[model samples]
Target: MNLFEDLRNKIGKSVAETGQASKRMIELSKLNYKRKEKKREADRIAEEIGWIAFLQWEKEQDIRVNKDLKSGLERLQYIQNEIKLLDVDIEKVKSDKLLYSDNFYPTSNSPSSEPSALLIYLCPYCAHQVGEEDRQCGNCQKRYY
Candidate 1:
């Protein structure tokens, strides 16, 4: 019967969606762990820079020309850049979890054949998910208007 078939299809779709969500969660968790590790490395590099500065000061040496300090600073900058890149990558992964097919396509029972466009807005500061009618970001508490 059509009713039984529809119910079976719905259950199958739900199971598939749950699986996809679990995969996405695992991907996000991995990315977040990487980002946290990068932050920790940044902190370590910062501590190294501080120690370098302290030693240079104790020796009454010119801090600007210190090769060790310079290298540490460079490494810190590189790590910061890496963290920024990871942030972008995390946002990309989050966006991929969106149900684009459901947003764009009409269901089988629908009379209209044309696909509808769904506009998704994100917070500028934190990339938090926001609705089109939202005036403020819920995550960052930043005002859009």
Candidate 2:
């Protein structure tokens, strides 16, 4: 009878120890789950910050690009204006040369061969030379005497 009582006592102690170990394991598992949740939350916040920083960078790039484009267009406009002025100057030089050459070589029908005090009419629309008896312009169809 004494041996059976000692065996029962040992069995009760072993059951109690097993229950305590099970409780400890449950607590440890809960702690691990909480840590994982905290880490996930931190990662989410980091992602949001990164997105905001990217948007700001994009805005700055847009401003710089716009400024560059505006400057380029202004430079192009200035160059075009200079080209137009140069073309006008070239036309004036050519007209002056033509006048000088014509004066050097007088035509057979020039005013020098005509009688003195000869009457001539000029067309007002196209500046065409006309005879004194003419009443209409032949080049631009304008009426002029």
Candidate 3:
């Protein structure tokens, strides 16, 4: 009877520890997902600002006076703040655990040859390669304009 009681206690502790670890993993994943989303939005807004400034320069207009550029800057700031908050949450969830950056492994996909003469343009939304004449991204279908 004593042996059976000790075995049951050990099993119960293992189950509880596994459940807690699973819950923490789920929380961490959710936080990381939200951080990625915020970062993507920030990237899009920064790209928009760059494009607006370029267009203004091409038209010989003042980029500072561009309303779209100003708006994109404000949105980018907001997204950056959100990313900071998500980072805090992720750190809290990952307390006492090794960070993703702690384990580093070199990737095997490095290019060995020189760059090609042809330049490839990637869509800002989906990162799909598009021709210079493409008005919309084929992957995301988002208009370039």
For all candidates, what are the clash counts?
0, 0, 0
Ranking by lDDT: 1, 3, 2
Which residue pairs in candidate 1 have backbone atoms (N, alpha carbon, C) closer than 3 angstroms, thus clashing?
A: none
Clashing pairs in 2: none
Looking at candidate 1, the ten consecutive residues that score lowest on lDDT are 99-108
Give lDDT tens digits, candidate 1, residues 81-137: 999999998998887766434534323455544434334477788876678899998
What's the distance in Å from true for residue 25, model 1? Answer: 1.3
Between prediction 2 and prediction 3, which has the larger lDDT? 3
Candidate 1 TM-score over all chains jointly: 0.64
Which candidate number has the best lDDT? 1
Looking at model 1, residue 28 earns an lDDT score of 90
Whole-model Cα lDDT of every candidate shown, in order: 0.76, 0.52, 0.71
Question: Arrange candidates by TM-score, highest first: which order?
Answer: 1, 3, 2
Clashing pairs in 3: none
lDDT of 3 by residue, 85-131 (tens): 99988988786344222322112246323211224577788777778
